[model samples]
Target: MTQEPKGILIVDDDQDMRELLERRLRRWDLDVVSAENGVDALEVLEREGIQLMITDWMMPEMDGLELCRAIRSRAFSRYIYIILLTGKAERHELVEGIEAGADDFIVKPFKKEELHVRIRAGMRMIQFERQKETAIQALRKKNLELEQAGATIRAHLEAAGKLQQAMLPLDVEHLGGVHFESLFVPCEYVAGDMFNYFELSDTKIAFFLLDVAGHGVPAAMQSVTISKVMNPLTLRARKAPTESSGEVKTRLLNFQDPAELAASLNRMFMGPKTGTQYFTMIYGVIDTEKNRVQFVQAGHPSLILLKSDGELKAIGEGGYPIGLLPKATYFAIELDVAPGDRIFIHSDGITDCRDANRKSFGFERLHEILSAKRQCSMRETLETIHRELISWTESATLEDDLSIVAMEFK
Candidate 1:
């Protein structure tokens, strides 16, 4: 079905010329409005949805040029097709016609047939301009909507990041008689690496350093669920305090000694309500008086040990990750911690992390840097690792979540 014609405005000083043009345009079945001058045309435009316009070049008070300029200034309207009916054919006058917003020119005293053909031709131009304006409006509206959607996503991510942080130890200052320092850098705004600490007693502390299988937000969600289940306060104070890093490692490696806790954790995760996301992790306990670490492994990346005497080594054999393989075995290992020895646990995002060149910041290079800087304090050693990793990747930004947990026995 053909849509009705949108109103077209016609302006001229001569009543005869206006009537003649109106009669011909009406024959083509266009709804037309006639104005005696620019002032009348502006008023007609304000009161109506004018889609096209035709005006005479010379008129007292307001001319066609003045009308076109006025049309251009009003941005609220969609578009106006202004074809000036001019007597002069001079080049300078033609340019002026263009500046005044005349889309085309039609000579005065032309044939009625020629005039009819020209107005029809003017319709084609007006339609084209209308289509362009409509497209631009649509694109602008879509762009604004997309920007708002992006902003909403970012806000949610920031809130999630803060909540995950809240699950960790809020006070890193002199907890359980062991000085603790940590550096956690996620590839995204949030990451998969998670750690938790509970003060079981003045002499004994329980904690866990975990890295899920992948990186970014998905992996981060797994850690959040585990943290929720493993919280000692929430679990009726079932967990212990992490007096030292060595204790944390010792507890993680001794998994076979107590399947009860591991089994309970397994059942909790296996519940239908829990998400089916798998993750590799290391959980542990620290004994302040004994100066020991007890830790369990669940197919996580190995631990890096830095001795006070400048010796560096890796710990724990491999095991199956959590949230995968229903009946897998998990075992714990014990390691005696020395007064200046440091144990560093991290996610794959650190070692297998890629640069712009797609090269990994591998374990061999990491050990080399550790051996070189082991003579320094635990804080300096950890920071050196951070710097070397940054230097290896041409682009310092991580492709995955980067997390490094370092604990030194005081």
Candidate 2:
């Protein structure tokens, strides 16, 4: 269907001129309206919604210049292009007309073709203004939709962050006569790092810390999945029954070895079904009665051990990261711990943290901090590390997820 042409208004005190212009414009397939003076012209314009106007320079009540000024001062739903009909030929007169808001002008005794060209020019300006308004409206609508989508995504991320935080170890500081302390920070609302320490038996305590390959939702989801599967019930050794005095009794064996646990996780996550995601982890078990610490490092940072006498040691030879290869092998290393010795397991986010100068807070600095804080309590030491890390990076947030789990023998 064709759109209707916008109406044009002709204003003049001369009836003959108004009638003649209307007839000519109608003959050219244009919608036209006419009035004898500026007052009547404004009434016709308001009633007809005309967007183009041609007015005589002089009239009894309101002249063309006065009408132009009035129209420009008032706000309308759309733009109106005005052309003045004037006999004045002086440059100053033309400038005055333009300053009064006339868009174009045609002298008296004008050729019909010149009049037609002026009308066409006015129509083109109106059309361009309409197009610009339409585009601006469309852009505003798109911006509103994007803002709504962003709000929804932010809400979901905040909820997920709370859930991830709930999965962390709580009040496990004195579990099985061993003291535990930790720190966790994420660059975004959700994190890819997880840690927990739980009692597997009366005398055995298990702890683990793992960092997924990246940050944000995908990595956070995978880290949550790993945390659930690494719980004591899933990773604990199977129970067996024995006959004692003809009575059947069941006893708990040792928890799953750290190496076997890593292997199992690798097998579960490696393959085409699991995508290309992988993670570094340190999983350990401490026997309180024997003062023995056994752990596996799956391509994770080495564990830091601070002895009671203030001697420091870095343990573990890095192994393959879990889920990277189908046949990757992991082995557990065992060490004897003395009373008051502290073991630290952390993600690489700490040592790899950088400052404005692009210098990494490497392992050497971490060792120095641990050695300097040896006299402090386990909780104080972990808090000191957290403060130092933030100070080193000189940022409220880090570039990656940061996590650390520290345990001290009783």
Candidate 3:
């Protein structure tokens, strides 16, 4: 590729000096332009693409020092390299010329070779400045592109968060004579924790809380898929209204069993076809007429039962996490409770929560809260627990998804 030569401007009151410098520099392949004085130099500078200038210190209208300072005051697209020519040998005078923005200086009767070498060095500096400016512009453009991409990602995350929230059951619900309240919090835009409760029949209601193994979009996506399959309407539709009476009765009974449901979900989510993600869950069914609850806990934190007498106990065997083993076994645990008793099911996001000092909010603290708030309304108890957890962490954001469901039998 052919490289375009740079422009060099020479300004001097002496016509001979201007012509000499112009001819010498032009031989070196630079485009040369000359002016008789600083005033004419400024005019030519305005009209030409000048990159380097050699100006005499003394002139009729404007001197080299004044011209250099004037050029420095105005912002230009490219840096201008200026060399001042003067007979003054005083150190202070040289310092003064440099402070006026002169890049270099040459004597009045300078050697041709020395002037050529100095001009060559100045041209290199101009080239370097142009390259630096180009690089800076490129960097700014890249930064702007990255910022735009970040904004786009944030918008998608917000939308995903809204969808995740819609997957949850209402904040408060009532089934038969039992009252339910819940709290959910995710550290990020979406979470791996999910919970829902729905009527299985006139005599039974079912609920579950599950936590996928990780946080963020991958885990949240898995939770969403599971929620859809486990939805009450979807499960009920599987049996169909057209089924024989015996088949419908048996299918509804199977749906009300926690062990059968947990094992089925584990199988659906297991194997290589499901990838390397797994979750812990607790599924339960309440019999309003019999006043009994049947539940299964699969590698999840213990479920808390607060008796009407203000006694709290943790139930269930800490079984293997669902999807961890294809042949994993789960057992149904039944609790026949008196009226006014309450039950609490939660994901490990609560027990595993840490404070600023890295202290875990263990099951002991949870039990104490439940026992103390036994007489409180379901909403009050849930809110108190949520507030305490936030205070312990000292921040609104959590390291994982926080989910809890509490139900009080009336």
Candidate 2: 10-residue stretch with minimal lDDT: 234-243
**Where is model 2 more than 4 Å wrong at Cα?**
1-5, 11-16, 34-48, 56-75, 88-102, 236-255
Candidate 1 weakest lDDT stretch, 10 residues: 249-258
Cα lDDT, all candidates: 0.74, 0.86, 0.85
Cα deviation at 268, candidate 2, in Å, is: 1.3
lDDT of 1 by residue, 1-410 (tens): 22334577889999999998898888878888999999999999888887678899999898888888988888745666778898999999999899878888888778878876767776776677777777888999999999999899889988998888777774344556666666677777788888766666777767667776666677788778777767765665444322254453113222223334554455445535366577777777778888887777777788777888877778987787766766676666787888888777877777886777788888888888778776666578667877777777866676776666667777
TM-score of each: 0.74, 0.83, 0.85
Question: Which candidate comes out best when scored by lDDT?
Answer: 2
RMSD each, Å: 6.8, 6.0, 4.9
For model 1, the local distance difference test gives 0.74
Winner on TM-score between 2 and 3 is 3
* Highest TM-score model number: 3
Residue-level lDDT tens digits of model 2 in 1-410: 22334588889999999898988899888988888888898887777778899999999899999999988988888788999998987999999999999999999989899988888888778888888888888899999999999999999999999989988987347888888988888889999999999987898889999999989999999999888777666654444343469785755433448887787777667746568479999999898889999999999999989999999999998999988987799899999998899999999998999989999999999999899989887778777877888899888888989889988888
Tens-digit lDDT string for candidate 3 (231-255): 8867855431212454522243257
